[model samples]
Target: MGSFTLDDVLAVRKRRDSWWTVFLVDPIACRLALLVANHTSITPNGLTRLSMVFGLTSAVCFAQELLIAGAVLFFVSFTVDCMDGKIARLKGTGTPFGLWLDYVGDRLRVLCCAFGIASALYARTGDVIYIVAGAGVVVLDLFRYINGPQLKRVRDTTRAVARENSGAECVFMDELLGASAPGSSTEEVRREFERAGDEDGRELVDLQRGFRAQFPWYDRVRMFLVAHRVRSHLISGIEFHAAVFVVGPLLGAVAWLWTSAVSGALLLAFESVLVYRAWLATREVARAVPVNEREKVLV
Candidate 1:
């Protein structure tokens, strides 16, 4: 624990984070990861693979109705998922391939866990409802996955237009929109955005700032629910496992099915909000760019 410092914790934390991770998970896991990073030679990709193993194991436990075991494994899986990136940063070994692996691994883990839980529940009770619930979760997860990159692209393209118009070295749209990497400087992001030359760029910046100011609580909650990274897509994984595998077994099969369905619904709602926000931001950026320039930049 002494090996990890406040700086180390800050190093791995995202510019925008969910409340759960900011307050709970990272406080514990990041330090643990720091210790592992200092003591071992494990690559970030290796840690990513380990997380997948834990996730798959948790899925199997859920399928067996081993609620306690499933919950424990699921938490471990998530903690390790956080650790891999921290470890990568510490080791200075992060790569595009590692990032790709982390994203794909998260998706696979969620899919496996959802299907496993549904299949197990159906086998025990002969209920088609569980299968439907699982399918719904999969679809919602898929949507979240697809929407994430699209949103990022829109944001990036819009920022590029702003940069071109302003001729500023640092546009900092990533920080303004909470898409920056962990440990990015907020002051720097703000300073750059405020320097935008054109009305559209400044308006978009002001709109984002005003939106945050107007709805502080909503902004706080949304940050906790969906942070900058692709793995945010799996935010529901812990809740889903806890509800269906842990709470469900204690309450009964009906409870499990209901919880699974609710988890899917919640994820769908979260992703919908994200998509809407992206649309608004994209429109703002498009309006700022000249129509001729928009066609050139966005494509």
Candidate 2:
């Protein structure tokens, strides 16, 4: 529709991404996005639909026990998945519907892949463990997605209320990290929100206070990771999916069990840390703020 370059696509790329994406997907997605932006009249939703086609096809390949082909197809589907967001951001074509579609599409792709992989494995080995592992993959993915956003909503509402009632000074680290990625400096984040001046400026800081107070070393570790442009979420959904769907397939059948196990453990471990830090922060906030809706629900 218009002239664009690789730089334009890169500029709209996320400030921080899952490390799997940073190392593997973006190098390809960005270039493809550049081509799509400049050449085709294809919309972001169109790309998303195309991605679903590729994704479902990959799932079929897995069901047929074409593990290598399935992995390659899945990777292509994922790379295309990455491009839709960039295209949306660059073209200002983002829609609420698009967000909903992208999210639903991802979840469905995971479910299908899990089923295909599980069925294939079970068919070959007749072992119930493969069936269970596939089901575990689906359940864990659901658990992560379901819990994460709801927890953030609760955290956001709590912090927003606490700030309003306590009349406490706004601090960037606690509130801002929930919205942005976790690696930004305090001053940089403050300046960013102040520049943007949206209501989204500060709502995640409750945990920051308790974290900074209770575990002073955590910030040092986070900062060290930031130096390498890596966010400290060591094992996120992206890594989980890649391990289960891509790396395991490439390595061979037996590898899936161990790879997914290791990745799942890492994911659960990080999730536990987030929960504990939130607990410390919420406990501190309860003492300071007037009773809010969250407290009302508990009572």
What are the clash counts of all predictions, listed in order? 1, 4
RMSD for all candidates, in order, please. 5.4, 4.1
lDDT of candidate 1 over 108-148, digit per residue (tens) = 88788778777887888897888888888777777767877
lDDT of candidate model 1 versus the reference: 0.65
TM-score of each: 0.73, 0.86
lDDT of each: 0.65, 0.78
Give one digit per residue, the lDDT tens place, for model 2 in 199-273: 544333333666777777766666656555556777878889999999998988899888877888888887787
Q: Give the CA lDDT, 0 to 100, for residue 274 in model 2.
A: 72
The clash number for model 2 is 4
Best by TM-score: 2
Point to the candidate with the largest lDDT. Answer: 2
**lDDT, residue 113, model 2:** 91
- Which portions of model 1 miss their true places by more than 4 Å? 1-6, 161-174, 177-252, 285-287, 290-299
